[model samples]
Target chain A: MLTFVVFSVRRAWQGFWRNSLMSLAATATMILMLLLLAGFWIIQTGLNAGLQFIEQKVEVVADLNDNAPADQLLQVETTLRGMPQVASVTFVSKDQALQDFRARLKARGQEDLTGYLDTNPLPNTLEIKLKNPQDYGNVVDYLDGQPTVVSQVTPIQNLVNQVVTVTNFLRTVGVVVLILVGLTVLFIIVNTIRLAVFARAEEIEIMRLVGASDAFIRWPFIFEGAMVGLFGALITLVVLAVVATPLQEFMYGFFRVLPLQFGTLVVRDLTLLVVGAGVGLGVLGSYVSVRSYLIR
Target chain B: MAPGSSTGLLRHPTLAGDRPPETTSERLVLALRDVAKTYPNGRAALRDVNLTVPEGDFVFLVGPSGAGKTTLIKLLIRDELATAGQVLLDGQDLGRLPRRQVPRVRRKVGIVFQDYKLLPRKSVWENVAFALEVTGTPGRRIGPAVDRVLRLVGLAAQARQLPTQLSGGEQQRTAIARALVHDPRLIIADEPTGNLDPLISWEIIQLLLRINEMGTTVLMATHNAEVVTALRKRVVGLEDGRVVRDEVGGAYHRED
Candidate 1:
């Protein structure tokens, strides 16, 4: 087994170097496939982060009736929390709400709201977090159906609906793009290997004549294809890292104008993105290339 | 579904004294029963040809242009299966076996083509050793096996050279070395020395005859009349796919 692996790898190495330009072309296809995938994943990650932030912080603030008692407010909290999709619940009392308003205004360098108002008009409410981004619409529907308390769930669900629609649409587009790019990679690699095989169809035919088992004949080619993938991934990762250096620095400088996560965290996440994308693309290309040869 | 289609396992036990080969009964190594091969575009390459090569024998398949000699060789090796009739190897029907099963049967046979078919990037050693390595031989055994075949084909000195750097004769010798490496019971040479001059051609034929003398059956398909007339070996003639003659102790010179 060890000998077989060694021979297989050696054949692959020789075959790879024999057609260096063709191998490079196949590798470039892999890199392009990976780059597209990585770019999509990064966008998806960013979009996911932004969506979750809004989901967690945004909620409907339903005011209670003038005659309503504290028990009724607790009942509303209990109902909202009982739903399976509700991730979390936080009830803000009127007094605590006033204190928060004052603190936020002072932080924003604004006048105190308590001094201008005769009473605490801010309604006590529960901030609801849906189980998933997909469930946000259902959460809005459930919250709007409550009428025992006074009407109106806060934070205007229309804009939230629009955001959900846009993000979902983009997610769908991302999936389609991923599949098309994957197939393009597959087609390119398969054709490259096929043309390589065609160039030596006589040798391949002779190999078949000399009692070479299909796997035996296929091993070297598959090994070559996979090594092509690995090499392509390595080169692509290098290119991505080079390109990202300036981009990351620019992002760090620009995002510094606002309070956000550290550049260090971005680097860590992007590293995962690069490696995952590269390996995935390489494996995909290798698989399609060998599959076509094996079928013949 | 031809008559007498054999599908038994080739269960010959690896008996002692089998290495250097020995004389056996006039056992037919390969039999083509009215085999016909017609291309899809309606070119008749072989037509109802009946030819049998016995074990331990050396036979030259001789014919003129459009004689279907190469096609016959291809059919025998399963490179191109016969379109109509059954091709039997050691009584196993070649047509019945699956494509995957063809290799093991092929292992019993070795073939050297006119084109040399050496992987251009592979060194001569690698070109020959590739045949052995793929058949799952142990690593330690490969060195001696390769060396023995190279010595037999007189390619031992040129083993390290790439196929591209070798002369036409040297490349053909390397191919012969590769065919001999596995010690297959049968070897097919289809116009192997077609591109070589008379001297080199004679040299290759002599080496093949020596291999045959050691009891490996050889089927060499060629159009070289000088080789046939000079060697006076068994000859099977094909014309438009039909076997015109199968004569023992035959020569190539004949009236038009």
Candidate 2:
């Protein structure tokens, strides 16, 4: 087995170099396909992250009655935090609300009309964030039930429904597009490697006639395919690495405020994804291509 | 040159004198009984072809183009299964052989083609060593085995040259060396000299006869009547997929 593996590797190395032009062509195709796949993957990841950020911002705000006691407001915050769906609940006192309204007016370069009133008209409010935006029904219902302490709850149900509908649709489309691109990559890579194998049909025929086992004829091509994949992946990664900073900058500038950072985890996952897809497609392509010759 | 004079030098260390003796002198190296083959296109390539070649026998398959000579060779190598009846090589039914066992069975037979089928990029020595390498022969054994066969085919000096660098005869000799590298029980040459001139063709025939004299069964398919008639070996004639004649000490054509 060791001898067989050593022979296969040696042959694979020689086969790759001997057919350098064909091998390079296949590698170039692989790199382009992998880059396309990785591009879509990055977009999908960013889309998901942006959608999540938007969903987290879908908070249910309830205005408390001006006369509601501090203890009641504290109790409401604790109760909201206890709920599984409620991610966090922050209570803003009337004074803090007045201050925020003044700050917003100043930032927007609008006159602070609230200063003209004899008394501050702002209401103390509870901002409730949900783990999942779709699960906002129960939290809204609970806040509405507290009629004594809460004067009114903002009717954002329609807004939440619309946001969920659009985000869900976009997510679905992203996944479907990724899948279609993945399959396209599979076929193009397979066909490219098939052409390479076709070029060596005479060699394969000679091997078959000489009583080479399917493994002997197949593994070398497979290893060669893997070599193409490895080279393609390494080259792709270098390209990606070179463009990564600018790509991230462009993404940040495009989406501006969206939390779309390519963290260490993302980098690692992308590296794994590129290498895995490159090598996997290469092996599968060669396996399927060489199978046609071996079956006979 | 004499028929058996080259046998001494062609003797394989592991396969010639040191090889185990056969169980029977009459053991059949190849047998096709009522074998019929119709390709997927409904072309009946062979029908009712019955022939047997005993161990160490030399036979010539003579037929016009499209007369099933190639189909008959395909059956022996298990390249195509007989549509009807059995093809037994060394007494094992090819039709009954499993897919995985095909390679093992193929190793028992060495095949040569008119095109020479040598890898253009590989040198003559590499081309011969390729057969053993692909068959999983040990690296240590490959060099000597390849050297022995190249020497046997009288191409040892030109082993380092590529196929295109050699003449048509040398390329065919390289192919023959590859076929012999396996020390196979049966050597099937399908129009091996089809591309060669008369003089070079005679040289190939002499080399084959010498290999046959060294105790390997040879079955050659040819359209070369002159060599076939001069050799006076067993000849099996196929016409439109049927074996019309089978004769020992036969000429390429009928004696009538």
Candidate 3:
């Protein structure tokens, strides 16, 4: 059995190397397919990360009445804590709010917020963080349902809605592109291996006549395809690590002015791609082509 | 039992007519009964052809182009099924055998073709060993088996040479050697000497003869009349997909 395996592998290697052009073409297709798949995966991962960051910061603000009693404010905090959707609620007093404003102003070298308002009139605020970004509306509804707090304003509501809509849209686009890229990769490798098989149809026929079992004949070509795919995936990973992340980060910085690391994202994604879809797809493509020929 | 074993030989003289047949009993090695075929394009490739080949018999089936010689050979090997009638080997119909069992049938009947389809990339020794290796021959057994067959075909010296590097005659002999590696009971050669010179053809025919003498049944389909007449073996002639003549110890057909 060991000898048979050795012979089977040796024959496949001999056939692959004997026709260098076909072998090279198969390798090239596998690499191209893997690169595209990994690139798509990396883009999807980075976009998902950015969207998750936005989702994490999405929350509701509660505006307290100017003359509301301190004990009543404590009642509202307790009310928020009882709701399942409300994860936590923090009270920001009027004085504390003013202090926060002054700290922001100090960063701009203009820490003089007390001189503008004669009565020191910033409202007491309630900052409500929810268990889910999508449940922000539920928190707003629960708080707004109260008779006394009906007039309270949430300035972050519009921004939250816009972020949710845009993230959902971008996710849909990402899924569509992922599917398209996957199909394109599959087509490229399948046709490439099929062409390789066609070129060696006579060899296949001779092998069939010689009583080489279907598996014995098939495994080597499949192995070759896997090798080609592995090589292609490696090339794509290198290119992704060196190119896509930096480009994505540059684009993100242009859009949001946030500090983004293109290199780190690419490195992380490339590792996943080279190991997962790279090896998987290489074997898959070869198996499909080799089985098709074996039937004939 | 071994040929003429003590179990049979001891009791045979007393039994007389009731004794079992000899080791050389004339059992049918291959039988094609009323086998006919028509291509999808409506061309009748073979029609109502009947042939019976006995064990240890070297029978040549001769015909001109389009006379269905190759088609008949294909039917025996189960490469092509007949459109009408049936083919049998040892009373087992070729049509009834599933493809999985076809390899076993092929193992019993070896074929050597005219074009010499040895793998160009493989060495001559690997080419012959390819047959035994497919039949699940162990690694140690393959080397000796391949060497023995290569010696029989006079190719032991060039065993390490690639088919592309060898002469046409040598390549054909390597193919023959590969065919014979498994010691099949029936050897079918379809125009085995078609591409060779007279001297080379004579050498191959002599090898075939020697193998036949060693008790293998040989069915050679050929176009060479001179070789056929010289051999003076049993001949079955085909004309337009039908059998025209069957002669024992016969020569080739003549215009006169």
For the second chain, the TM-scores of the candidates in order are: 0.86, 0.90, 0.87
Going through the candidates in order, their DockQ values are 0.50, 0.64, 0.29
RMSD of each: 8.8, 7.7, 7.5
Clashing residue pairs in candidate 3 are: A31-A232
CAPRI-wise, candidate 3 is acceptable
Supply candidate 1's per-residue lDDT for A236.
64
Worst 10 residues of 3 chain B by lDDT: B8-17
List the candidate 2 regions with Cα displacement exceeding 4 Å: A2-33, A39-59, A63-124, A128-167, A246-261, A292-294, B1-25, B41-43
In TM-score terms, candidate 1 sits at: 0.74
Instruction: Kindly list the per-residue Cα lDDT of model 2 for residues A204-256, writing each as its tens digit.
Output: 88888888998998898788778888899999999999999999889977866
Q: How would you order the candidates by DockQ, starting with the best? A: 2, 1, 3
Whose lDDT is greatest here?
2
Clashes of each: 3, 0, 1
Residue B189 lDDT, candidate 1, scale 0-100 = 94
Better of 1 and 3 by TM-score: 3
Q: Name the top TM-score candidate.
A: 2
- Of 1 and 3, the candidate ranking higher by DockQ: 1
Q: Please tell me the TM-score of chain A for candidate 2.
A: 0.67
lDDT order of candidates, top first? 2, 3, 1
lDDT of 1 by residue, B115-203 (tens): 88898878999888878877778888989999999999998899899998988889999999999888888999989988999898988
